[model samples]
Target chain A: MENNLKKVDIIFEDSDKCAPLKVLEKTLKRTADDIILDLIDSGLKGRGGAGFPTGLKWKFTRNETSDVKYVICNADEGEPGTFKDREILDRVPEKIFTGMAICGYVVGAKEGYIYLRGEYNFLLKGLLKKLSDFNAALKKLNVDFQIYFKSGSGAYVCGEESALFESMEGKRGEPRNKPPYPTVAGYNSKPTVINNVETLVYTTMICHMGPEKFKALGTSDSRGSKVFSVSGDTPIPGIYELELGMPLHDFVNEFGDGDTKAVQVGGASGHCVPRKKFNDTIIGFEGIPTGGSMMIFNSSRSMYNVLHDYLEFFAEESCGQCTPCRVGCQQLLKGIEAVKRGERPPAYLDDLKKLTGTMKIAAKCGLGQSVGNPFNSIIDNFREEIIY
Target chain B: MSTTEALVKELVEKNGRTRNSLMPVLQGIVQQEHFLSEEALICVAKELDLSAADVYGTASFYTFLDTVPRGKNIIRVCKTITCHMKGKDEVIKAISNALKIKVGETTHDNKFTLLSANCLGWCHKGPVMLINDEVFPELTPQKALEIVEEYAKK
Candidate 1:
């Protein structure tokens, strides 16, 4: 299996061949329904941590009977351990814009926006230049759609789709009540479709290469290659597009420091798999899913410090509107501190575990629900590191 | 009226007079003034047909939009997991000791304000710091202090 490690490059293959304008020109010839059908058959999922089916999201938004629908590409890549979107934006921004334009064409929307994070303000100038070039090409091809860019003001919760819409609307970046989802009432109460930067790039690929060819890459559950931002305690710490469903042990053997003890699959909100379970863990939807953040830790690192860093991040970034998230994060962080300082009994951690489970069920959105993931996983795997 | 106020008014006019333009308008004002002043927030609120509370709520929600005054240059040290494992703590300590200020404080000379940020998205080159818009990655304690001293001279 190690000798036959299949690595595929669908999104960041090359600039000219995957050029946005060229891909758009080819994709625009297909009817809207055909494009949507191709996406549906591609078996692609949102690469922004959430494993939601990408085709279903586009289909829902396209079927909505709204005259003023909107398409947004979520470039607010604020997840602490994730940075593949940043690399993508820097290398092949045209592919992202092209993907958004294709979404606009299929979903019957004329306007699109890329809600970029504020830390990435430096990228604005170059991305705008690319957008203008894409727009000029669109005009030559007589495409009616236009794409705009919005800069987010450094809020992590705004990475949430509804909160992103709110931030784009010049309001506080907070999550909205979900029943009338983004597909029904979003971005000024119009039916909207939002895709992650990576997801949209794959959309372009599904259009360029037929869905059957695209689906032939990864396992049955997870299709296509995933661009992982591998950092922390690795010999080669950079971007890697690996076939999904690869075992964690195989991944560590290839990229690890040879002293790898554990891996944090995904960002702060993702799960932690210890070395004992590395062979059992698969890097895909069927096993331990991720948003392409693989932070490997060796024996020298302390799991206590790791958990503290993640809890602190969640405490700072939680959008405080909901009680379970706002207060629950504070309690969890404080609880971990007490445990590390020997102030709280080990039984106190059991209570904290119960609290995190409550936060998972009661919190308003994904942010609150996922804050407990790392908290529970780290505690479960490294209780010794915490107590001693 | 002050030139700054007039310039802000012009920006509000240029971006358009709508509630949706609130973020861009605030971002523009912060870029020029380094922080959002009370008068500017009120002015933005009035121009965008939002209350001052609304403007303040939105402005304070984002970490980049400072509600209070900041130093001439903002130095953000990345403290995410990768950077932490790469000895970001030592780099942060070097800057603090060199500047004679703590993590969340500004230099008395008002030249640099030190801050700890979560993942500047340069984890590949671990232990990174962003001085204003420029990223300095693969940093050590000595290199971090030298970078601070270089900025201090400026």
Candidate 2:
């Protein structure tokens, strides 16, 4: 079995010379167009599960003609199994701030905000101190951009770009409709560039090491390495900067506890790949793209419990704006419980699967839409486990 | 002005009386008072020039914003999948037994509140608990009890 799993050392490397501020200084010298072009060339996608091309997002936001554009670093790391963003913020916070500043520069915005989740309130004091220093540095550079911290009040939906904007606006963190996307009308109904914390750090890294170096790693779709938050049923459970497009089999061999039966790629909203399908699966944009969450489950763990937990999470976390997600999540949870309780027949699981299918399209935001990914994947892979 | 009114006014002054300042204003009250009282909410609405219903609407949407009374120290145990798998039930049980109260209940002395939270983002170091702004991760039942006892002493 040939292993294509390659571990990269770019993300956590602590060299004082190639610091994030140095990257920002060099990036500031270049035109906005040049920076956007380099980002597009690198083929970097959003690391926050959505996989939208990072360069195109910046380009769109840059093209938008507005007087008061804004830059936001989405530090609301609420995804169940994904803890890499917090680790990034804890370790290389300047890199994130630099990325936001660079984005502000690219998109013609003077103000930037980091929407840190309330759960990570513990990180706030340290982040605020670092942010003040970074803001001072930006002022010394005559950049005119100052980053601010906005804390999310324990809402998972706020991780969604528009919901994050709403949360910042002191409203319910319900996602707004598209067409007026973040690129055009984000915070305060102005053109805004909102990116995940990791995405921002990668932008800083790309500026520092040239786009070609990042382009040299991973597949065509998923270029460069990503910081993965690997946990559950693994001996070495922690953050790993691994090259994307690696086969799940390779990941399992490297990180799994030998008895790994299934792996939850991404978070609870992501897919579940059984051990049998591990060889066929790829962990990248071209395959099962993740937000750097890979939770491995050993054979001893019950698939029913896993699916139940995910359903419960979605049901609780759903913003209740739409019926498909709000009603659908609760029904699915109830339907599974009834089946397990011997009230509903085993075939009733198919009806619940169909409900998730409806939720895929009917639900308003990603929270509702992607619920079926884990629901269907777990049910498909371990049907018997979900039933008696 | 009453203390709550003074607090709300100070928060409004610090954060501004804009609609955008509502969250921070509410958060400030929570930080000082532990939860948003009706008087605090009304005061914030008056200061921010919003209806009480509008203020409550936003506050109720967030899990962290407690509308009801909470203890001096909030003990939020992570009840997400990873935490559950890593013996969060036992940790919760330990805390419940220690505090002599179930989940979502505060101590009789109003010193600590025991509640279950969705996820605290420390999946690798599972069975985590957040005591107010601080976090305790990779917790055993005994470790959890010890931590709670220390808080109780304080």
Candidate 3:
């Protein structure tokens, strides 16, 4: 019964992932470096929008000072059209727990925190039972690890790695300047390793499959399988795992059973590849980020309204600490309004373009840069809709 | 009622008798009692010397802490894009239909409260529902109702 495909459904398929987790209880005696090498070889990237190499991120934490290190699983997955982590937390909480333990063991950090979103408090309602079960598994495995959950205050920016760390410290969730990069200074100024919930949850699978076997599925640029939400106009819109190099035409129609106009890869921060461009686009770096969110829009949808949602999200969620993000987000919205209301001549459109460029270059952190992505992608792909 | 003199005195005493403790005092009371009733808000305002408007603003701005009494079980289905496109609206409807109540409303038994949220940041799991902080994913309408029914029995 399709043995190769891994399924860790707590509520769905009887129990596919339980095998690897059971094997982990017996194996996993090696140090953290072995796990990192296995991760690097497997070609696993962050499931969140960033798409950073999981191995490379772990390497940075490995390189950092040993004393007072931290391992935090960034469960604060607030990106639009991204529900992969919540699924892992809810359905496969044990797998996520195992991955967190492996990370803590690899990084030699005793403490781990799952920085979950506050809206997920209701999700956590039944999870304490699972957590207790996981804790019991940890003692059984003989790993000296302790993990706790810290709920997010529902700030979208807190989804950023640094911001998640700051929020865990009980401050308002806001993105901090990088260069320290959380690998160096994170979680109360300790050397920390933060992985997206999916990234960590997948480690147990890789630990069982081995890296090269895990790498066998996807493209060279983006290895292994990715989970897609595939919402919007799709008859079978739900999560499906596909290889990274899979064709968009096939991917779109795979579950998005409809006449498609465009595919918004990588959720709100990702690009809107027009239907014509679908042939050339793959879900990876050589392609756009699958970011694990594939929202297909048909003719019925308006490009303007879609772009508006992204801009509005940024405007409302900006941390308000930095000028570029705090002010530029509002300006982008105002300019959109100005254009929509016919207040600006077509020539004024040049200013909006230039301002977006300025925000990209001068903004403080990932929030500003990420905010630029949705606007940039819309202007590039949907210029015709935007211009008139 | 949050306004009983016994509870109010305990809350104010716990927060210390300072004007600055107004928000903290109300927040403390809510944490203890699980909902900030109108009487509790008034008690906090009276004890802390802050306007009721100010107290209400602090309470409502953050969505985590509730001001009104919540149902015995709260189902916060993510209305975020990942969830929405995956039939979150339908899921909400299913919950409402089963409970015979609408979103943001409680059942007559006060056993379930249904509400929608932006994103819980776990976009990987579409059509996700959080029942009091523990999320359940990939829900069909029937499965959701069954979960709600279980909670109702509790």
Q: Can you list each candidate's DockQ?
A: 0.78, 0.89, 0.26
* lDDT of each residue in A1-388, candidate 2, tens digit only: 6778898988777799678888898999999999999999999999998989999999999998888999999999988999998999999899889999999999999999999999999999999999999999999999989999988889999999999999999999999889789998999999999899999988988998889999999998789999999888999999999998999999999999999999999999999999999999999988999999899999999999999999999999999999999999999999999999999999999998899899988888999999899989998989999887
The C-alpha stretches of model 2 lying farther than 4 A from their native spots are: none
RMSD of each: 1.4, 0.8, 6.5
lDDT per residue, candidate 1, A1-388, as tens digits?
A: 4533567788788757666677888999989889988988989999987878988888899899988999899999988768899999998887888888899998899999999988888888888998898887877889888899899877889999999999988888889988899999999989999989999999988888789988888899998889998888888999888888888888988888889988999888999899999888889999988999999899999999999998888889889999999999999899988977889988888898899899989998889999878988988999999888
**Fnat of each prediction?**
0.71, 0.80, 0.41
Report the C-alpha lDDT of model 1 over B107-130, residue by residue, as the tens digit: 887788899998778888979988
lDDT of 1 at A333: 90
Where does candidate 1 stray beyond 4 Å? A1-4
Largest lDDT belongs to which candidate? 2
Model 3 per-residue lDDT tens digits across residues A169-283 = 5444567877777888988878898888777766777776678866877778888776666566777666776666766766765655567888788878777888888777766
**What TM-score, to 2 decimal places, does chain A of model 1 have?**
0.98
- In candidate 1, position A279 carries an lDDT of 86
Please provide, for model 2 over B1-154, each residue's C-alpha lDDT reduced to its tens digit, 9 standing for 90 to 100.
Answer: 8999999999999999799999999999999999999999998988899999999999999999999999999999999889998999999998898889999998889999999999899999999999999999999999999998899899
Better of 1 and 2 by TM-score: 2
Which candidate, 1 or 3, would have the higher lDDT against the true structure?
1
Ranked candidates (DockQ, high to low): 2, 1, 3
